[model samples]
Target: MEYDPTLPWYRRLHWQVLSAMILGLGVGWAFGLPAANAIGWIGELFMKLLRMIIVPLVLTSIVSGVASVGGGRAIGRLFGKTMGYYVLSSMLAALTGLLMVNLIRPGQNADMGAAAQQEVPELSTPDSAVDLILDIVPNNFFAAASAGDMLAIIFFCIVFGAAITGLPEKPRVVVTDIFNAFFQAMMALTSGIIKFLPIGVFALITKMVGETGFDRFAALAKYFATIGSGLTIHLFITMPLLLIVLGRIKPLVHFANLREPLLTAFSTSSSGATLPVTIKTLREKVGVSNKVSSFVLPMGATVNMDGTAIFECAGALFIAQVLGVDLTIGQQAIVVLTALLASIGAAAVPSAGVVVIFIVLNAIGLGDNPEAITIVGAMLAIDRPLDMYRTAVNVFSDSCGAAIIARSEGEEGVDTEVRH
Candidate 1:
């Protein structure tokens, strides 16, 4: 993580993005409304570029990756390994958050009485398990892709890829090559789009800072700090340790290779939005095969949300403290499970973590309080900065899982890339 004297500063994409962010913050703070009016479109353009290729990249990558996984046994084996890593990582994150909130006790002496005027959003109840099941099998394939039902698209892609593997050898090679070719083309487009990242980060950060100044942080700094601290520990400590112990890869080398997607995730605050960069970075820079990054990352973007699990767990506990409701040991345990499971089918759920906090609160019988709702409303107003941080953690966890799983699967040079 030190300065590489051999590599020129201007050549480092991460540092360029960081510099853009700092400059954008100053521009936004100084110009306010004018800043947003002038430069917001650039950021929007950047997002559109990132999003434009997602459906195709995901479709081709998974189809190609899964189809090339060798056989049915390999597909299932990789599935089990990926899901196991995802579950274990998210569970650990929930535990870390649970411990952090209890230690910090940020909501203990808080004043929420005057926050009645903040606009509270309606509670977003997550769908039942059966509804999630129904969402997976799309009634219409192209319709689902057009509607951006990633869960449906993912399920279909998986089945389609598996079917390809079962085809006669001559036809199977033809289909796999077609998909592999498409995936490479999409990746080239992704690389072109990523070259504009610094500009996009600058504009996006500028717009955000211009619109919402620092005044919002006046209240609920403690809650923000709570989430921040918990995420920091999980990001730098929990995940790296897991990588070292489980993946047997050099964490620093892995980290250096992943700067683009991490910075992209932070600026965008959307794991799905930053996925093309994630996939491309893993393939070209981190040396993860399309076989693992392709399969693991898309699903991870939707299903494995370690950061969201931590945020929801800490958020629910913080809300409980604000309401003076001391959760029982059993209730706290329920929070842990809910937070972990709530992230399962998140692609189909809008604001999956934010809306689902009520699910956690209601699990502990605190759902119907008028004052608590207002506090939640108030908290929503100041959540963007923390949202950005946690989104980065989410992306990082996905990358870590890819690297670890790739290493476990015996992908040589995985996380050992030294691209300058």
Candidate 2:
């Protein structure tokens, strides 16, 4: 809510990352492969730092988030409706990305000789739906955590945290506090790592451009277009349809009411930071009651990230396409599921979806590939603006959920309690 408009532009994170990327491009273009090979290690090291934080960060953030959900029939129905909307919306958003990527085929015929350095390696798609299911519930939690298997960790933590909610008050409080503190600690650690994003972006871009000579960047433009189109469909077509059919609210009025929060979300690029404005707009201008707005908006901000979901699914598939790896139907399904789960974990970090795209790539068996990080770093270089757009879609989806749920609950004047 508070911003210092007078601050110098270069002092901002996005601008700094932009400057680094431009510098990387110049150095690589002028000096060529030698420059790329020299600085590539720094970028790889930055990515390694990211992988280092994943296990603890995923474990703590998810469990602590789910632990906040209370148990009882008093709010059970409301909880179910709220969660159903979040889950369904997020799935549709991701599926939109999946559809667009396959149709556009943005990564087709991309020249990666320098980047791939060999024949296109076969994609490591998921074996079967049954195997994927089995993989989700690991035999040993600690073993899964140690192996850095995110799917198993996410499943166990969700179930574990839900069970904690059903526990007696005293024990629940004790356990919840521990995870909460640990989650904060991990976030602080992540914040520190995110600070080096410019360095990482610079190294990755310099290496890729140095080797491949900007051909991939052409594909990157198409890739960016693919994501943008998917997000636009989900934002304009899908969300407005939900508003009309589900909430019975006029899309025009709702958009008008949300003008302030959407702009704030776009500028800040953070749903968490824009929460105060989102809630106030939904409750005051859009005409939802306090009870509905308070409960739904907070949880939605945490777990209901529709825009990020689309980005994750599309990003993983685009990476596969770029490396000429064909993802199987089951593997695509895995991308969808991973995107959903990663959206929940994404809430705790600075560059939420950008960081989690690595997780989606890893789930689809591409994490170990050194080349994957190169493209990811390129994506990071252009991420700030993309992040802004998706984040607005995210906040807008949350408001729509609150409005629809309030209407379904038989609350009068839903989206009509006040007019801006």
Candidate 3:
């Protein structure tokens, strides 16, 4: 296929996203909340459309990727590399956030009294670790699909993929080809839907900015600044350091290659929603092999959440500080471990961070009081912006994981030296 340079800039995905963000901010500021509210349906519709396709896309892509990895041995290697990177990066991110929050103490000056007035929903404590494990298995695929439980979907995909691997050659080839075609069709559909992303993003942002206003921003200024600062440090400093030292890729080139997907993830605030863009950027711009990008990005979207993990850790500490709860060394260790695991367990959905925050609070004994949960609610008022920032980090880490995995797989010819 020949490159088409005559396409209008607005027709391009990234440019559209940029335009939406700019226009959204402008509209929100000018006409205020009511005007922003009028267009809220556009963002709602966009999210619904994305949610509609998520289950099938995740299922088909993961199953096809796993099946293509071939028998038990290849699957083992792929799993090891993929999970290893996820676990390590997620832990590092969690720790990074934890360290920053501890040092800065963003909530130290905040009043918990105002937060106490907000009615906090009573959260049920999960029975045990075993119960959590049991919950991973989907009793009904339809139920899981309806609920958009990504971990459950991932569980199903792995098993289904393995089954595909065991089938006889003729049948396997036919089944694989069918899935491949389905995956492509879904991608095409996603592309068409994303053409409206600018509209959706504009609506979403305008609503957010219009609703919150400058007053709320002033109230949570410190907390937002803390999380934002942490994300910036990780995205610019830590991640790039890893890219250069561990991945052996130039940081600027990797960032340049990742511009499109990073922006998409930032705008969407859902890594799963940004998968198509991530895959395309890795394959086309960064020159990762399809086999690598296809395998890594989907799995990373599920299990590899460096950004969310970081937010969870920082959020936990911020809440703890506001509540005057002093976490011990042992308790901090528990936060690290739980946040890492919780990141893996978190569903790749819009409000998933709230659920994960609840889990983290419960783990650290902060869930006993309704007041603590209310404090989290205060955090939620500013969560959307921070969510976008963290999501960009999430997608960046995923791409880095892909590059590292691709190198290990001997598919490094795509970018021997990452371009600036």
The candidate scoring highest on TM-score is 1
Instruction: Mark the regions of model 1 whose C-alpha exceeds 4 Å error after superposition.
Output: 1-7, 114-126, 347-352
Comparing 1 and 2 on TM-score, the stronger one = 1
> lDDT per residue, candidate 2, 1-420, as tens digits?
223578787765556666776897899899889998999889778656766776676567657756775554535676789889999999999899999999998778754443322222232333445766777788999999887655677678767877888999999999999997986686567667766767776886677567656444453677779889999999899999998998888887787677666755664466765565576566557777655675677667767899999999998898899898999999999999988877766652335687667778889899878888777777765565578789889999999999999898787776662253
- RMSD per prediction, one decimal? 2.4, 9.6, 2.9
- For candidate 2, what is the TM-score? 0.60
- Backbone N/Cα/C clashes per model: 0, 0, 1
Q: Which ranking of candidates, highest lDDT first? A: 1, 3, 2
lDDT-best of 2 and 3 = 3
Which residues of candidate 2, in runs, are more than 4 Å off? 1-71, 111-219, 348-350
Worst 10 residues of 3 by lDDT: 116-125
lDDT of 1: 0.86
For model 3, the stretches where C-alpha displacement exceeds 4 angstroms are 1-12, 113-128, 413-420
Please, what is the TM-score per model? 0.95, 0.60, 0.89
**Residue 168 in model 2: lDDT:** 93
Report every candidate's CA lDDT. 0.86, 0.75, 0.78
